[model samples]
Target: MTPPATPTSQGRPDKPALTVLYDGACPLCRREIGVYRRLDALAPGATVCYADISDAAVPVPPGATRDHLLARFHVQDRDGVLLSGAQAFLALWRHLPGWRWLALLGRVPGAVWVMERSYRLFLRVRPRLQRWAARLD
Candidate 1:
């Protein structure tokens, strides 16, 4: 299904609503991204795109290095704004069918702040989780 022509702040509709940048090499990340991919495929007129940042062939966004992007969860919005951490997840959840409620919850005052803090904690242990997931592969 074709995405609706939603205008960005600059009045452009050429860009997809989101472009998710992910580390394909990380088993944990790959599995999570797989879930999103399946959901996106099932959603009619889904406007989210995925970019495997681990792949050398994928072009990194301007002013961002591949390593920096791979180090965190990131999504580029329709206006080409790059969001990281919980903000990125919130943006993605808003688009996914079953996940929109969580996005709404995130909109509550201080909810995103808490989520971002928790995400920062997760980042600290992500390498260990990645190693464990790789072992299961």
Candidate 2:
């Protein structure tokens, strides 16, 4: 992952930047991450780094692989807590400027369940989505 331009604020280096681990091999995931990259660029200090796990240049944690990341999003917070799937998305939303409300909603009773189910449905159809995206490329 390329280091983003240096943060303008001189803060503690111990503050971990938001690390988003995504599937590089999936076209649909790539398109979504591209949008995130653009948004992060607009909000400079918003992200520490982003990694496409499918990239040979990117390092994966022990026992992790491209297929694992393709199944869901993974986010590692500043304190080194790892969140997956819907929980990961919620964590990310919490960090975004105005989307903190979505994060709160995600934690509401049954919200995580709904998001997880929806994510599963998306995964089920992702192969077809990838093919469709590829045709456009």
Candidate 3:
């Protein structure tokens, strides 16, 4: 499928919006997404959007199942490039004000590997955090 042509922040009408799918039920996820949403509002030209993957009815693109989304973070770039885990986070940071530097830094050698390892470590305790979040919410 041809990617729809869209205007970039530079006013070139060929960039696609960055679409991020995240777990709303996860407290940490909610907090971070909330911050990014607020940041997105400040820069309307950036065209970053989000979807809550925690909802069973949320429609994702073909080839991505609930299990797949639940397993890691997902970000579909303007070119329809799908990224997961640390890459997903980097995709998101690239659009948000004050985060572009970190995103750029992530592209450095071994940064992604370190982030992915950290992400995996976080996943190890995600369930417990989710339960705690449930009680707090």
Candidate with best TM-score:
1
Task: Point to the candidate with the largest lDDT.
Answer: 1
- For residues 1-85, could you state the per-residue lDDT of candidate 3 as single tens digits? 1234565668786744688788887887898788999998899565777778788877776777877887788888877778899
Counting only residues 3 or more apart in sequence or on different chains, how many pairs clash (N, Cα, C under 3 Å) in candidate 2? Answer: 0
Query: In candidate 1, how many Å is residue 73 off?
Result: 0.2
User: Candidate 2's residue-wise lDDT over 1-137, tens digit each?
Assistant: 22333434665344446678888787788887787677666664566467777787776655566567657889776656667889988877776666678889975899999999998898788889889998887
Determine which window of 10 residues in candidate 3 has minimal summed lDDT: 1-10
**Cα lDDT of all candidates, in order?**
0.88, 0.73, 0.81
Flag the better candidate by lDDT, 1 or 3.
1
Give each model a TM-score.
0.88, 0.80, 0.83
Per-residue lDDT of candidate 1, residues 1-137 (tens digit): 12235566687876688989999999999999999999998898778988898999888888889999999999988777899999999999999989999999896899999999999999999999999999999
Clashes of 3: 0
How many angstroms is residue 91 displaced in model 3 relative to the true structure, after the best TM-score fit? 1.0
lDDT of candidate 1 at residue 37, scale 0 to 100: 91
TM-score of 3: 0.83
